[model samples]
Target: MATTLFFLLFFTPFLYSAAAPNHNAPQDLVRSSCINASYPSLCLRTLSSYSGPTGTPRDLAQAAVKVGLARARKASTYLKTSVTGKSERERAALSDCVEQMAESVDELSKTLSELKHLRGETFEFQMSNARTWVSAALTYEDTCVDGFEGVDRKVKGDVKKKITNVAMVTSNALYMIRRLDESGGLNR
Candidate 1:
């Protein structure tokens, strides 16, 4: 019984360690230290520089556009460098980015339509053109990702940027479009 207890105590820890899921494994302390050492104050700077509104009416439309553009850009880069069979994570991330871009474009369209109604004649043509451009970009992005691992897939990158840019330009097409709406400038 003494020998059995000793063996149980000694082997239990090893058995549990082996059974643990790999995903739950703790990150390497040394690697984290190295990253912090190399990056220094970069993370702090980013956190401090965040421009998201803190007290104002958070413009969901504008935020969506910005996030969409950023995600599209990231997806573009990922697609450029990703290799087959090793891009599961990258592919998933790209999909998420594309989805965000699409959602932002939709939001921007709705906002533009509202602004058009508010601005009337001043934004009529410009808003119409902007909608057309956004629709085209969305369609392009939606169709870009086709054929994945021998199956049909639709992947798009930076589409949000294109749509946002067009919407922004349209938003600025007439002086009234910018002035009538309180969403700030396209440059923002």
Candidate 2:
């Protein structure tokens, strides 16, 4: 009976200790720790840093826009080349990305123009537009990302470029939405 009690006490602690380490396992220990320590705010801050600004939502949006423009330009070139002679799926993806890019540019331009005349009540419309634009951009990005999945690494430069362009346009749209959100324009 004493041996049983001894084993229970000794083995239980060892078992617990072993399990504890698993929680701190190498796979995602660092990420988990950081997330636990900071959470949503920290996540936002980290994302903002990608644009070289403080944790403000506007900065995050701006960063996304800059990245999108650069990516879209590159992708546009590739898309132009790949669309010429490609499979139906490839052609469809390229076309979709291009369309999304055009939409993003149009939305962004309109938002910027609206911002010049923005009043308190008008902010709501601006916010709504921003959200819609961002959502569309994200959708386009998803399509492009999915299209590239399982594609041969040796895919032509043009194909890769189209994918990149779509990604950039989407990214920029997201940034614009973030900016609107941060500006307190969408709070209502």
Candidate 3:
């Protein structure tokens, strides 16, 4: 009886610990959610930094927008003041790109603030607006890229890389927000 008791006690924790490692639990939520995204890898990589066991789809979406905002802001700043040695047309295009990127940053900021005002039935409506704004931000970034065309190839390449990264992350944020609607993030 004592030996049996010893075995039970010794194996109980081991059994429990063995059962605790659920591979599906850690990333299943994020992976499944990101599966619908255009850039699933980028979505996962950008958002997994904010992942937690208890994080809901809403939280993930918010974190994505925050990351997008930071990237857009940094890109805007770089375009505004850093690049040099440009022709007249190149300088004009660079200036316009910086302005549009700043606008994109503003749109993302509005999205986060507006999320706090959503109601249950209207949650999708609010989310739609947010998604539209995000889309617009991407459009703005596209316009910025377009402006860079026919300019200095080197300068355009650098600025394009930065803006494009911001656009990709914003795209991920929009998809995450869409996932929120499916996950019942609208209601209290």
Indicate which candidate wins on lDDT. Answer: 3
Q: Write the per-residue lDDT of candidate 1 for residues 57-135, one digit (tens) a residue.
A: 1222233334334544544455445435535654664455445446544544555455334344554555455445444
lDDT of each: 0.40, 0.52, 0.82
Model 1: worst 10 consecutive residues (lDDT sum):
25-34
Give the TM-scores of the predictions, in the order they appear.
0.33, 0.47, 0.85
Question: Per-residue lDDT tens digits of candidate 2, residues 1-188?
Answer: 99999999889988888777453232242233223222333333334345354233344444445445555555655556667666676677667666755665555555444444556777777667766765665565556555655444555344655555455445544544554566584322
Better model by TM-score: candidate 1 vs candidate 2: 2
What is the total number of backbone clashes in candidate 1? Answer: 6
Where does candidate 3 stray beyond 4 Å? 18-26, 51-54
On a 0 to 1 TM-score scale, where does candidate 3 land against the true structure?
A: 0.85
* 31 Cα displacement, candidate 1 (Å): 40
Decreasing lDDT order of the candidates:
3, 2, 1
